[model samples]
Target: MIEIACDESGADGENLVGGNTLFFAHGSVDVSVEFAGSVISEIRERIRSPAEEYKANHLLREKHRAVLEWLLGALRGRAHVELVRKESFLVGRVVEVLGGEGAPSGEGVPEEVWGAFVRAGNRLLRVRAEVDSGVLVEEFFGSLDALRSAVAGTEAGEMLARLSGRRERAFAYRASIPTLIPVLDPLFPTIVDTAAHWSSPGTPVHLVHDRQTLLTPARVEWIRQRAEARGVTLAGLRLVQARSDPRVQLADFLAGIARKIAGDEATGVGDPVLGELLRPYLEAGALRGDGARKG
Candidate 1:
């Protein structure tokens, strides 16, 4: 079975909001251990930084620009990065949970108007008046509530009126279900995507990831099941410390740099050249900035 080494940066679990980082980036490398070790040794020789274990920050500096460029170009073919915006995810969940499956059609209002309101609802959640995640979730629900007036006398209004009662119940149920909370964690989706990417045909892939508290045995099984459902074969998942595995450390470097690049792009401050270099590896389907879609 082929093996893929993986790591992540800015991982805040499900606590995307009120978390330390603005973006999460997951990286997977399909390189051999020997290749990873050689890359690390080359960097140690080039930068000559006294740090025992090298990190992304070490190469991100202006002085190391040349090495960073060399590193990105070298791993272009084998490394892939997945980027996600936390708040935008919540806005999407708002639409999925409360917006219902099928689109609404009625004499109450035109379908076009309904579409506008849906977009508006997403915008409402994207605009954060509060920093507290709990309050942010409440505000998301409240944004739905406040829209009652905005969508009044329209088909969208009727739909919101119906979902009004379910919001509180949804919140209450989520609180009671402990397992549901972990499932919301972004790491799970990133893992599933990495597994799916490497799982070729009938050949299952054994995924080696950096040690993370969230990668419990049960969760690893869930990742396998999820991968299978998506037509990907996962042999199994194994966790190792970054120090013990050079491959995992390399994955960390890619992830760390990717996260920084994504964050810079979100805020409109970054080296344009470097951002373009990492662009090809960044997942095309992840939500962009705080609320826009990317491809």
Candidate 2:
């Protein structure tokens, strides 16, 4: 059986607005628990001692960087990691578009529009134009029709016609998950499914999430139902404070590293050492960024 401990960072108001990191581990429960304690102890010691190069404002300071590098190195192949980040403005735009409100003007384009554009071919250029111009929905659809008529005999027109049949129910339903869960929807299932796949067949899975206001009983039930439908047996699902569980603390640091990287990306900065630390998981296809999908 594989035990998974989960935590998140940047979900709270932070450097990267709307940015979040969902990190979890799948491995031997006892071993992970033990290692978590050791990692916590190491971090505490490093915090007590000062390192000259580790400035106060640095997101990935030297001591924190050292601890993360060590933790990630130790977990390299033993545990799987996944990351999902969304630009808040982009997410808000997506919510607005799908929710069918134009009252609030926004700068970013919705993910569905991009998906529709890709699937609908060049005729959808008018839709893109309308969006870029911040046109109202009615005007945008009118432009779409006009473009369709102009390209009626071409291949692009046929693709544009196909876009009309795309099912948007799934995208709309995701909006109901509430709070940060909507942002986390894409990552949760992928990580759970991946962990299930890696575990021995028929072994029961236990999931422990770091406490969050959004993770209410109803939400847990919703997750359970979704997992059941997917054929993944979740033997248990519960929320606990990180301070009460060592494994959860490990998950916190893991998520923190990913969040710092994302914060760096948003601000157009780079940390080579941090990037190097995450390289193995990225190369192994364990850590993934689901930026294009709206949660």
Candidate 3:
């Protein structure tokens, strides 16, 4: 049996956006070239559409299963794939473990808490992966670095940052590939005990700049209405709504709206009304700047 624990860290907010990170450690069993190839293939097929792809399962589930199955197709064997994801603080701690301290912490602590057992489980996987000295793990961390760089200024950064800081806000995992090992050993309790103490207090996702004021309510409303008609949610409409400027770049505005919407969903309020409410300053550049009537 191989245990894999994956984690992501980042922030999601209107301003002060950062990026998200995903880290997972797998048992020595699946740390093979064949398994890595299969997992990559499955993930590529899965992420074809961002709209459809969700972080519902652990990173090493079926996506990694394809490789194992392909390699052991002929023989009748059994292996249990246990996968878990811990984002935000737990992710931060794991990264601290991998890269050392001084990694940036995310904002907002999750309401829930992660005990030592879970931490131990996570670390055990990491230890196994490191001991194996698999080049794939090195590559995985490399890609994570690139992802962080790509979303530095945008909403992507916010979402990434949000996930990195919270302990309870992680995605789900599933042990998709099942194999029969005569004797599967449980991880030592001491490993879990060691990691149980990791914790980072919740911090607010505050904007670096002053909060933008709501200006042209009417024009913002009109654009929001149009955005809604085009299948954009009301909250999404608000992130880019600017009452005074009707000629704003639709693409940039939409991009901002999309990022806010992503975080909004994670925030648990998917209502369109919220977006409509913020329409007045969507294009004003500064929320508190003068409206069309002012200048």
- List the candidate 3 regions with Cα displacement exceeding 4 Å: 1-85, 102-132, 151-267, 270-295
Winner by TM-score: 1
TM-score of each: 0.78, 0.58, 0.19
Tens-digit lDDT track of model 2 for 1-295: 6677766654432222222432222222223777777766666666655543221123257545666577667667655444544433233333343443222111243545443322222222112222322233333345445554555666655644553333252233332324534432344444455445434558767777777676667666666666666677777767788788877766666666665664565455757677677655442433333332222
Candidate 3, residue 209: the lDDT equals 11
* lDDT value, residue 166 of candidate 3: 27
lDDT of 2 at 23: 29
TM-score of 2: 0.58
What's every prediction's RMSD, in angstroms?
6.9, 9.2, 25.8
Model 2 misplaced stretches (Cα beyond 4 Å): 12-30, 49-59, 87-198, 263-268, 282-295
What's the TM for model 1? 0.78
Single out the weakest 10-residue window by summed lDDT for candidate 3: 181-190
Tens digits of per-residue lDDT for model 1, 1-295 = 8899999999765555556777878888999999999999998999999898899999999899999999999899898877777655544555455545323322354555434444443433342323444554555456556666566877766777777666555555344534723433578877888877677787888989999887888888888888888988898888999999889998999999988877777667877898888877765544245322221
Name the lDDT value of residue 71 in candidate 3. 27
- For candidate 3, lDDT tens digit of each residue in 99-178? 33333323332222222222332432232333333343333334344444554776545544543442321111111211
